[model samples]
Target: MPSPVSDIPAATPDLAAAHYAGKLAFETDCSDVRAAFAAGKVDFVLLDVRSPALFQQAHLPGAINLPHGKMTAHRMAEWAKDTLFVVYCAGPHCNGADKAAFRLAKLGLQAKLMIGGMTGWADEGFAFESQAAAAE
Candidate 1:
């Protein structure tokens, strides 16, 4: 019979370490993102791939709306080509984030998926600002 998965933790330390390293490389948690925003020293741009109406309702402090369905050359042309993008959607239940990441990749832009979407931020009690507020 095969042994239980938990019984082999010590034997797979390298695997665990590599997995964690890879995760950190591809995903970032909200706290680190918030800190970067507050410090005004970020290595990537934040993107929210939701409908304009939803975006207008509320979004991350610095996230710019780039609706997944409307992703196109004309829409993307204004943004810097080399900037790394961190994308999020409504929440984990929403696949808009993954779709947006795929589109960004197709456009040859570097990107990483934020571990949790906006819901994650709200769950952590982070404030969301409306587009109207941002306009001011």
Candidate 2:
């Protein structure tokens, strides 16, 4: 196998960190996320970290609700081991996704924050499903 350092191709430690940060950021975005979902990829689960009320207002399709505050190792007992969770909240103004990811990490679960979140998805002209709409 190639040397791990040479494989990444970073000129400096700072640059390496920055590059990895950007690459990590892409783990969750509207277009890429949507494509992954439509293609039925099994590696990740979309997690809505917002409260049920907010999730009811609108949320990404197929996302499961798990409020950051209520998240704990025990609360995640039902989740399969090693399954990646893509966490998101209302919008950029909301830090719920980050908090949720942190909490999940504390419990040894893998989680990625969906950048731009609900607002970002809606801003891209994609539609969201609200409880009201679902009921109608």
Candidate 3:
């Protein structure tokens, strides 16, 4: 089987170090993600590569919805070149994040996959936000 990170675009030094150090790797433990959020180390964009309806139901707060299919076009204009991106899909088995990460890398954005995705986030009891809800 192909490594999950194989499809991802160029890895930034932080991500590369994380890969070697086993930090910032795609993890099923959402607590780490929450901690990153709490520490303000996650200044990158959080992207939901799921469908519109799924996104409307629930998503990470501050996550920008950029369904995978739209990523190759102008919709990606919402993000800046220097923006670091954390992409997620439905779950670990899902490859949407990998594909999105590849696209982001092709576009020259620094990107990484959240690995465990939303299911992991929900399992960890981390907070979620709806499209209509305001960000904290």
State which candidate has the highest lDDT.
1
Off by over 4 Å in 3: 1-19, 22-29, 132-136
Ranking by TM-score: 1, 2, 3
Global lDDT of each candidate:
0.87, 0.84, 0.78
Candidate 3, poorest ten consecutive residues by summed lDDT = 23-32
Model 1 ranges off by over 4 Å: 1-11
Please write out the lDDT profile of model 1 over residues 45-92, one tens digit for every residue: 899999889999999988888887787878877779998889899988
Residue pairs with clashing backbones, model 3? none
Tens digits of per-residue lDDT for model 3, 30-81? 5655677788877777889999898988988667888877887476777677
What are the clash counts of all predictions, listed in order? 0, 0, 0
Top candidate on TM-score is 1
Which ranking of candidates, highest lDDT first? 1, 2, 3
Model 1 residue 22 CA deviation in Å = 1.8
Worst lDDT run of 10 residues, candidate 1, spans: 2-11
- The residue pairs in collision within model 1 are none
